[model samples]
Target: MARLLRRFAETRPDEIALADEEGVTTWRELDERVDRLAGALLASGLSAGDAIAVHSANRREYFEVMAAAGHIGLRYVLVNWHWAAQELGYVLRDAGVRVLFTDPAFAAQAGEAVEGLDLPTRIAFGDGIPGFLPYEEFLATGPAGEPEPQVMGSPMFYTSGTTGRPKGVSRKRSIVGMPVDVLALAADGFATTFSLPGDARTLLAGPVYHSAQWMFSFMAFMSGSSVVMRRAFDPAETLRLIDEHAITNVHLVPTQFVRLLRLDPAARQDFSGESLAAIWHGAAPCSPQVKRQMIDWLGPVVNEYYGSTEAGVNTIIAAEQWLAKPGSVGRPQPATEIRILDSDGVPVGQGQQGEIWFRYANGDDVEYWGDPDKTASIHRTGGLFTTGDIGYFDEDGYLFLCDRAIDMIISGGVNIYPAEIEHVLITHPAVRDVAVFGIPDDEFGEQVKAAVELVEGIEAAGELPGELMAYCRKSLAGYKVPRSIDFLPELPRTPTGKLYKRLLRAPYWQEASREI
Candidate 1:
């Protein structure tokens, strides 16, 4: 891959490689920056497999550092900017990060967090910080004439754990690195598959720390596609960039889609343009209604891929197939194998609800950092890692996810997946968002409970608990319906936009215990 980057620099030195609100960077500039950064890292005594933690938001320096790290085989950890000081401290200590690259906005807080720790070095970008190395000074080291090619782990991305503490998943270059052969396939299916004539511009709006953004950004760089990055998600600014740059591809989360759709309808009145060939949505489930509205608003360019930070790319639901399946996540990728297995590890027949397990023929990372026990629990015998998601495959081989296995509610010997009920509840015109969980019940062991966020105007009136209960009773089975409903203005979500159902369940369980 280092050779590939060098080749691109030699072939199209002046071609634009990256663009942001600040300015654009040509391939030559990017290569030069990476070379200088690599030299600086080596001079700082960062050897192969040494961990360098980056604490920043979306920026070109982040990508440059990542490429340089990958080029030299150093493990680059993309830290979550939203994490509290205590959380950051834990991860830094656990990874034994030798160097920390931080954004100036977070310098004060990050400095406080690492005060007593034996951190190797701290380099602050944008706005200088006293007692810390500035980004520009660090990059002035210049290229060290290319070090030995080290093919160590590429990245250590932390998962947004809704159920427990986030786990770091490290993938070695030989394992998680995307092969050149697969680039042709991805290019054919994802970016400019058919035309491939004009220069492709991809808009990256998500945070660089997340796997979804990393995949898109890395793929764009490898494919020689120009990338336009946004500092953060801003609907108006995002739309403006699309119009200005004529972006051909975009990768977004479902939450971003929701906000973008809510922008003044007039903003999209005559928004007819063929520049956007594809819009990839993933990292969390999208409401069926939301998906439909997106298709209607943006034509049929929406595409969804299902996988985790641990497994790079699992399945892809193309536009044509999405129109047919509606809620299906499409079939597994060509090099992957998926199976629906019962609790006993036996494969379930078609249409049976079971845990989803996947294995890659081409080899993939399948463990959590420093937690082999948990890793073993998930990545079971024979290389099949249980996704912990309960779902079934249709006769046509389409995968339909019900809900997380941990989120399932079992009442009086009846198993219920909250997604089945949440799907129905979200369809209600009055309900803006909803989360379903289980609360303890003496009679049934556990009873279904829902926490809902109502649409704006509906909340002005008093509670409509009875009306919502009646609505659910009419459409769902009496046992499957939520036993109680609590309305809230919003639900807690992870940085990646996944609902924190465990937090919602905590209060109900605590109250039940107090009553007992």
Candidate 2:
């Protein structure tokens, strides 16, 4: 892809490209800003393919920086603002980030992470911070001039690994890497069959750091749709923006959808047929009940896709197909191929539960940034990549997911990614040891549940659950917040101290063990 913004600027210069509460940017304006920002990045000593980490919320600058980086073939590492100092440092160092762009509120926190290292540059947005270059000042150093595009490279996306450390998944989409004919076919199918308009107004409700958010935003931009960006997901504000902007396309995780549905029915009543085009939910499994409710309340416009950062879009459950296969993730997209394999890597027959493996001939392929061994482990000799998710293909060819091959939880359709959550939870003063697992829920499908072993003499304060939840809420998204707390004497573990989450998840599976 030619820097995405460049194509939009050339094709739809006058069209509105981005919209937020602060302001709207036309394609022409966005192109101008990206040019200036790219110049600034170049002036800051960033060369082609050099990594630059961004630690900011969902502001226009976020996309601007991403596009600018793409234009210059500079690697953009979108830092999860929810990460602590240590987590941030690990990613920055691992990615070899030369510069870091962070919000003013997080300047001090980011500073703490880059303390001992010789960081390339640190530019703070919103307000000037001591010892940091202000965003305004950085932009003033370079004039608006289009930077020549370098040879296309892959985008490096770091997966929020729940089991081990986070791994980088790079996706390479060279210039015309995939034929536009295929893209148009897929895009048109999504638009017409799912009721998504080509020029729809979209509001990205979730954090853009994730691959799901980036994919949806990219699809919308490629289709000439206008995006309404949110700094963060607030149910009430999201609803208000939908109404105010007449947003047609809404992409969110199942948790966000649940929250929207939980809003006052009267406020939800304001959303009529024409006001919204389609609601796309993914990143995790959604409850069949929630899907039905969404269809009933909003119309038959709910769509779902099951895929991951490591593996590109594998299967999609369009609205029409969803009614047929209630909990299924539908069939693989046209450009993709999927197979369920047994432990020995042999393909399993239909209706047999096995690991889901995928292959894409034309789309982006999995490229682990620095770990060839990690990359090779997932890819088969034939180029198929195992999703590490246990699912089966029904006779009708729809894919249904079961538990992960690894102990991972999908809370509110956002990957709670247990390891990251556990890492944060273990830092609490009262927590002696902790094991986080996913518990089945009616609305969210699965909720993040933390079973903590409190310190020996510390009396369990009844308010610890609420306090711990509050602490996590401040650092993580609400969906990632642990919904239930269980005080445990000890967590079920192996001799090596690895938690067996299946043992932790057993009690919650009693009532509806095999039901949808």
- Residue-wise C-alpha lDDT for candidate 1, range 231-333, written one tens digit per residue: 7788878888888888888888877777777777777774654688778888887878788888988887888888878776677887778889988998887
lDDT of 2: 0.73
By lDDT, who's the top model here?
1
Quick one: RMSD of model 1?
3.2
Cα lDDT computed for each candidate against the true fold: 0.78, 0.73
RMSD for all candidates, in order, please.
Answer: 3.2, 10.3
- For model 2, how many clashes? 0
Off by over 4 Å in 1: 144-153, 171-198, 363-365, 456-460, 470-475, 511-516
Clashing pairs in 1: none
Each prediction's TM-score versus the true structure:
0.90, 0.75
In order of listing, the candidates' clash counts read: 0, 0
